[model samples]
Target chain A: MQSIGIDDILDMESRKRAAFINCLSGAKATNLIGTQDKQGRTNLSIMSSAFHVGATPPLMGLIIRPDPVPRHTLHNILETGYYTLNHVNQDILSAAHQTSARYDKDESEFGATGLTSQFVANIPAPFVAESAIKLGLKLVHHQELAVNKTHLVIGEIQTVLLPEDAVADDGHLAITEHGSVAVTGLDTYHELQPIARFKYAKVGQPVELLGE
Target chain B: MQSIGIDDILDMESRKRAAFINCLSGAKATNLIGTQDKQGRTNLSIMSSAFHVGATPPLMGLIIRPDPVPRHTLHNILETGYYTLNHVNQDILSAAHQTSARYDKDESEFGATGLTSQFVANIPAPFVAESAIKLGLKLVHHQELAVNKTHLVIGEIQTVLLPEDAVADDGHLAITEHGSVAVTGLDTYHELQPIARFKYAKVGQPVELLGE
Candidate 1:
C-alpha cells in the first residue's frame, strides 16, 4: 500500500486535489434537485451530496458548497421553500449531468438540457419526468457551518412518486430495478449490480444473505 | 405512477418506514469507520452516510444516527479525536457487515468480525487490513443537529493509504477496479459497473462521454 500524508494532498494542484478528495466519499447518490423561482421559472441542478439525515421524520440533507456564482437551486428553494429530488437513471443521466451547467436565471435547465419539467397540482417545484423515483421535499433547516462557511440544507420528505411495484413488501425500494445510477468522484457514473443484502446484524447470530 | 404523501409515510410501520426512508439517499458510499478508545480498544462500524464535505481542506462528514444504545464508534472518535474510514471491498464485505454487531466496550469488533487491525506510528485508530482504500482523519467539528438530534461529525483527512496503481492521471481512483462496492438502503451492497464519465458541464456545449 502507498501512504500519502495531508501535506502531500495539500501540495497537489487544485483540480487534481479535487478529484482525489472527491473520490474519498466513494460512490455517491446522484440526484437532480428540482426547484422553481417565485415567478414560476423552473430550475434543475445535479447534486451528489444528498444523504439520509433521519428516517423517522424522513429528513434528507444536501451539502451545498461555497459558491462564487449564483446557485439557482438554492435560490429557488429559499424563495419557495420547496424542492424535489429526482433519481438520475441510466437513460437520462447525460441530461441530468447537463443540469450542472450554469445558466441564466431565466433559462431553465429543463429547456436547455431537453429534459421535461413535471409538476403536480399541490407542489410548486418541478420533478424530472424521466426520473423513476421522485421525491418532493420542503426546506426544513438551513445552516452555514461556522467551520467552513459551506451550507447544509435539510428538507423533509413530503411526497414520493414511483412505480407501485418498485417497492417491496418489506418497504425496500428496488431502485436498481429502475436503473438508478451511482456516481464516483465528480465525473464518473456507474450502474449498480446487486451483490447481496445481508440480514440485520445481531451480536452472536449467524449472518443471512437476503436476495436482491 | 403512484403518488404517496407524507401522511402515508408517517402511517407506515416503524420497520417499514425505516427501510422506505433509507432508500431516499439512493446509493451510498459504504465504509467501515474505524476508531479506538483511550485505552486503545478498537471499534469498527459500517456507515453509509460518509460524504465529501470539502476537497480544499480534505474534509469528510459522517452522519451518526441518534442511538438508542451506546455508540462505541462515536465514543471512541470523541475520546481520541481520530478515526479511519475504510472502504468495504467485495472480499471482506460480509466481515465488514459483521462489524455492526454490538459488543462490549473492551472487545474489539476487529477480533469479533475476524477482520485484522492495522496500526501506524502517529494514529491511535485502527485501519482494516482487508480494506483497499483507507483514510485516517482527525475530527475537526462535531455538532448535534438541532432539528433531529442526529450528530454530524466532520473530519479532516490526515492520511490516505491505497494501491499506487489505482489512481488515474486525472487523480480519480479506480475504486471499482479494486473491487470496492457501493450500498443501497442499509444492508444491500452493489458492485459498480462503469457506464461513462462525462466532461464538466458547459452550457450549450455538446456532451462528451468518456469511457471507463
Candidate 2:
C-alpha cells in the first residue's frame, strides 16, 4: 500500500491535484445543468457534483465553485429560480463535456455544443433534448461554504420526464438501460453494468438478492 | 415519454418513492464512512452520497439524513470531528452493504459484517481494512438544510492511502481498475467500465481524447 499525506497532496501541480482529488471519491452521476439567464438566453454546463439530497420533497443539490468571475449557470439559476438537470448519455458525452469550457455569459452552451434545448410546459428553463431522463427543479436553498468559496445549491424536484419503459414496476429507473454515463474526475466516462440488486437489509438475516 | 409531476411523486409510498428518487440521479460512488464515538466504539455505515467538494484544500462532503433516532455515524463524527471514507470494492460489497443494517451502538459493524477495522497513525476513526483506497478526514464545516432535515457534512482530507498501482502517472486514480463499485438507489450495485478520457475542454475546440 502507498500513502500520501496532506503536505504531499498540497504540493502537486494544480491540474494534477484537481484530477487526483476529483477522482478520489469515485464515479459520479454526469448531468448537464440547464438554466436560462434573466434575458432568456439558455446556459448549459456539465456538472458531476449533483447528488440526491432527499426523497420526500425530492430535493437535489449540486456544488458550484467560487465566483471569482461570473458563473452563468449560478447566475441564471438565481435569476430565474428554476433549472433542469439532464443526464448525459454516451451519444452526447463530448458535447456535454464541451459545455464546461469558459464561454461568455451571453453565449449559450446549447448552441456551442450543438445540443438541442427544449422548453417544457412553460418551464422557464430549458432541458437538453438528448437527455433520456430530465428533471425540472425549483431552487429552494443555497449556502456558501465558509471553508471554500463553493456554493451548495439545493432544488426541489417539480417534474420528471423519461421514457416510459425506463421505469421498472418497482420504481427503479434503470439508468444504464437508457445509455446514461457516469463520470470520474473531470473527463473520464464509464459505462455502468448492474452487478446486483438486494432487498432492503435486515439485521440477523442475510440480504436477499432481488431476482434470487 | 412519460411525465410525472410533483404531486404524483409526493403521493407515492415512502419506500417506493425513495427507491425511485434515489436511482433517478444515476450511479453514485459507494463508500463506507467509519467513525468512532467518544467512548471508543467504532461505527461503520454505507454511504452513497459522498461527493468531491473541492481540490485546492481537498474537501469532500456527504449528506446525513435527519436523525430522528440516534444515527451512530453522524453522532460519532460530531463527537470526534474525524472520520474515514473507504471505497467499497467488489470484494467487500456484501459486507459493506450489510453495514446499513440497524445495529446496536455497542456492536461494531466491523465485527457484525466480518470486515476488519484498521487504525492508521491513530486517526481516531477506523478504515475498512479490505478497502484499496481510504481517506482520513477532519470535519471542516457542517450545514443543516432547511428544506430537508438532512445535514451536509464537509471534511478536509488529512491523509490518503491507496494501492501503488491504482494511481496514474498524471495523478488520476483508475478506480474501476481497483474494482470499486458504483451504486444506485438503495440496493443496486454496478461495476464500472472506463469508456473514454478526454483532455480538458476549451471553447471552439473539439476535445482530444487522451492517447488519441
Q: Please give, for residues B27-81, the per-residue lDDT of candidate 1 as tens digits.
A: 9999999999988788999999999989888999999987788999888999999
The DockQ-based CAPRI class assigned to model 1 is high
Real interface contacts reproduced by model 2, as a fraction: 0.77
lDDT of 2 by residue, A1-212 (tens): 98888889999998889989998898899999999977888999999998999999999999999857789899899999999999999999989999989998778999998999989965799999999899999999987888888988999999999998776767788888888889988789999999988877778888778878
Candidate 2's docking class is: high
Those runs of model 2 whose alpha carbons end farther than 4 Å from true positions after fitting are none
Measured on C-alpha atoms, candidate 2 has an lDDT of 0.90
Error of 1 at B47 (Å): 0.8
Clashing pairs in 1: none
